[model samples]
Target: MLDNAKYDQINPPSRLLMGPGPINADPRVLRAMASQLVGQYDPAMTGYMNEVMALYRGVFKTENPWTLLVDGTSRAGIEAVLLSVIRPGDKVLVPVFGRFGHLLCEIARRCRAEVHIIEAPWGEVFSPDQIEDAVKRVRPRVLLTVQGDTSTTMLQPLEQLGEICRRYDALFYTDATASLGGNALESDAWGLDAVSAGLQKCLGGPSGSAPVTLSARCEAVIRSRKCVEEGIRTAEHRDGDDEMIYSNYFDLGMIMDYWGPERLNHHTEATSMLFAARECARLLLEEGLDAAIERHKLHGGAMLAGIDAMGLEVFGDRRHRMNNVLGVVIPTGLDGEQVRQMMLNDFAIEIGTSFGPLKGKIWRIGTMGYNARKDCVMQTLSALEGVLNRLGFAGPRGAGLQAAWDHYQREQPS
Candidate 1:
């Protein structure tokens, strides 16, 4: 502790974040977080909380009353939902399409659930027919899937699966952290029981807070599992059975009571992060959901065209690609890490590498939120082309930039 006492004066490189997450946050969000902090239970703070809930209601495209911010990252929201809703021996069905699906199964297993997996190969999504058959056979209590799996750049179709889950009397849940602000997702219309997201991806904010919404059904289930904790012990005959809550901190039952009208004390709220989350949702809602989705589509389309013009093969089925991210196969004779490192250190750009079976085989480029603008797209493509050219990949000069410009031109009126 005594050595190296002085902190290094440093400034982070100004990077064009073109990765799967932690994309550049909207400047408005930064300003909001920088605003004066208030006490956790300050009236102003609570008012901000209420406003955040209303704002994210629009972000999720849901009328669900249980929408709010969880006090951690996206994965915390995922675990909160699972730990709250699932009891021991409950049968949970997870459909594996990418790394996140495996994460869901792993979390559910930790909850002591009998987890069943319906899987498709990586870089593909599960068909409705396959899911229907699995749901019918498994008779699971909950059917969970990731709306967008960034690792594979695939969007799982949910329009029909919601009806399937309803018919089977199983709750449907999804983690939309990677897709919410960039794609069209209707939580209420899609019959989603619960959904969770984070601001690090398409929402254009920091990753400390998680935005979550739970349907009335999901809320009711969590409320039913409420337990009296030792900190708030009472002397009403003192004969209650102290059944163990799965996780005290993540207990949605207790959390709901804390956040609901009763306003019981729980952990101190992450006030700054909550402010940031609220502003992120406010920005999206002000922009309009359809417009945000369209922006993502336009920029993502430009990215695809740019990558194609570079003479590199794009991975995954074209018909099912996610609107904000693209997975491109690493060209032959070029080191993927070298390209990624060059983009980061040399050009101040950040793109993603693949995971699991797709690792070292593909590079994931994202066009999302603040980074989905035309300039960002063009700059990324331009830098990428230069990097690729330096590595001996042959392509038409300035082809990627030209293709992206052409796509943008096509979007303009005659």
Candidate 2:
């Protein structure tokens, strides 16, 4: 038996998000999403789509022609790249630093690639020699890794791996979902073959759009596997020479055609997500990518200092931590989840928990996107101080706030 229930108008609590991701989006981005929709192939909509391509190229620091959006979360973009490029039994080498690295390995395996993984401890990242050595040993067709793994709060250095891949004639793909905009990533300059990122992090937008870029080499590999759907095929068009892509929605070649000059229909574009992505990039470019990254740096530094002043140990290698998030080691004799709940229920604040081996061991604090501000950092630190004190975990009462204030003060022009 079914009972009909009436739902009330949408109203949600306002929370200051200080977690690993899904951070508060810029209000400007939300406004852009609210703009009225246009037809999928309407000249105006196509025009907006083209503009989005150009804007994301700037955001990714790449000149690749295949740069475009996947109409889903960050993971969708990653899958689109992997499923399109990886063939059955093709060798792929993955260097796992954290949970997202494991995700890459899992996706590649599902794509039927003969995945080989070399791992570093959770809190650390791999060295180039280590990766190069694995590449030499496996001689894989593709090398997949994550630029930043939010689970471990580690940003893997990618600058040297590209040249190494080139030496072996292997494609290099990195998931940059956790590090773009707020951190340094030069796709063209670093020689990455494919890169994917999401709007929910440093891009200051919601989670629906994933911006991806592919080098000519990577595009060529994906194009080889392209096949037109029977419904959309015309007599003039023949199926691609290679195997048909496994996933209809994730076929990059078809997606490329949709975003390309051909404008072949695939799926109705997620117009609102596109608008949000465009505005996110527009705002970053307007401020200058370097300045936006520096803003993240300033605020992220303050948060770290405040955590230190609170007598909390920061997790992982400080040298390799991402600019927008930090991992604070959970204190002994205190319930980590309880602290998180008190902060949420009392202060209207939200932070994140760890996963896998790190579960209940640390909390991930983020200063990213729209919430990367002095005030946000100060408020978060103050709330955390109060929570810790109430839990009978005493530290210098005002020390965290003072440390953050001191950092901001010193950053002032002398």
Candidate 3:
């Protein structure tokens, strides 16, 4: 029989989120999200919108004026960038190294793009020459890839790809969801034409908002697909003659008008998420973006050291790994799910299982966002040690925590 029970007001368990994403949001970001709402056209609301745009410019390390929030999770930003510029049958080249790369290909195919792909093994990223060779062969209209793929715990080197795309007359884009705030991503300096990221990772915010930036070239292509909604159309409103975007909500051109000086009504913005995104950027900028990235590197390295000392093998190339997350191979004789369940049920901590090809092979642990701290690292490592020991997974007792402390001590102990 179904237990049709009434639940009390929103009580929830407190668990340290040490997984790949959706970690505990920063307290400051939560406070910002709790603020009262205002009308979309309210001066204060519009001012906040403008400030969000400016703040994300710094967060994304770009001077492009199109930097703004997409009022959905990270993939919405990816869709917006892809569907805005990709015409039916337009050639798009995607390099697949992990699950999210497959996501990029899927989104592009839905946009009616003639998608081409180059791939690497799950734990490896494509080299510049490999991508350049594909670009030269495909002569694609756009080249899309992921900056960090949490599924395999690898970060593709993007600094050189941008220049390669330009040299080959192809536009460049990357989904920076797993890496943006915790890793080094130089949007303008790297020649990136489009970059999209979510606030849930190293920004220490919830997962609703996605911030995106576009170079002038990318913006021009989007403007070519511009179509103002009939209800809000003014005499001065002009529609671009190119292909109309399939998605009304994901349309970047109309969204630009919504966020631009025109103050055009597209969709009612998610006010709380806007506040959260703003606060996330404000917090990051206050800490200095470089400093925050270094902090992730610090905690991430400590976690890696602890895992390694416990005799767990990291799943990918160490040189190309993102500083925020890593994949630990499940021990030979233990069920991965049992270990994760014990960590959660007994220790009140949360970590992630891998996806796609890596599914059932590894556990993805993250040191990012508000949870990227020494205490969190030590606690998670220690708890996993306890779980593994009880399950008869062998490694030295107390060694993991000691190794993590030694790493902190050797670097910058505070």
Each prediction's number of clashing residue pairs: 0, 0, 0
User: lDDT rank, highest first?
Assistant: 2, 3, 1
> How do these models rank on TM-score, best leading?
2, 3, 1
lDDT of 3: 0.92
Runs of candidate 3 with Cα error greater than 4 angstroms are 1-5, 226-242
Stretch of 10 with least lDDT, candidate 1: 236-245
Worst 10 residues of 2 by lDDT: 233-242
Q: For residues 125-214, could you state the per-residue lDDT of candidate 3 as single tens digits?
A: 998999999999999999999999999989999989988988988999999999999999999999999999998999999999999999
Clashing pairs in 2: none
Candidate 2 residue-wise lDDT, 1-414, digit = tens: 544455556788999999999999999999999999999999999999999999999999999988999999999999999999998789999999899999999999898889999999999999999999999999999999999899999999999989999999999999999999999999999999999999999998999999999999998888777455754654434444335576889999999999999999899999999999999999999999999999999999999999999999999999999999999999999999999999999999999998999999999999999999998999999999999999999898999999998999888555
TM-score of 2: 0.96
Model 1 TM-score, 2 decimals: 0.95
Q: Which 10 residues in a row give candidate 3 its minimum summed lDDT?
A: 233-242
lDDT, residue 213, candidate 2 = 97
Which candidate gets the maximum lDDT versus the true structure? 2
Candidate 1, residue 189: Cα displacement in angstroms equals 0.5
For every candidate in turn, the CA RMSD to the true structure comes to: 2.4, 2.5, 2.9
Q: Would you estimate the TM-scores of all the predictions?
A: 0.95, 0.96, 0.96
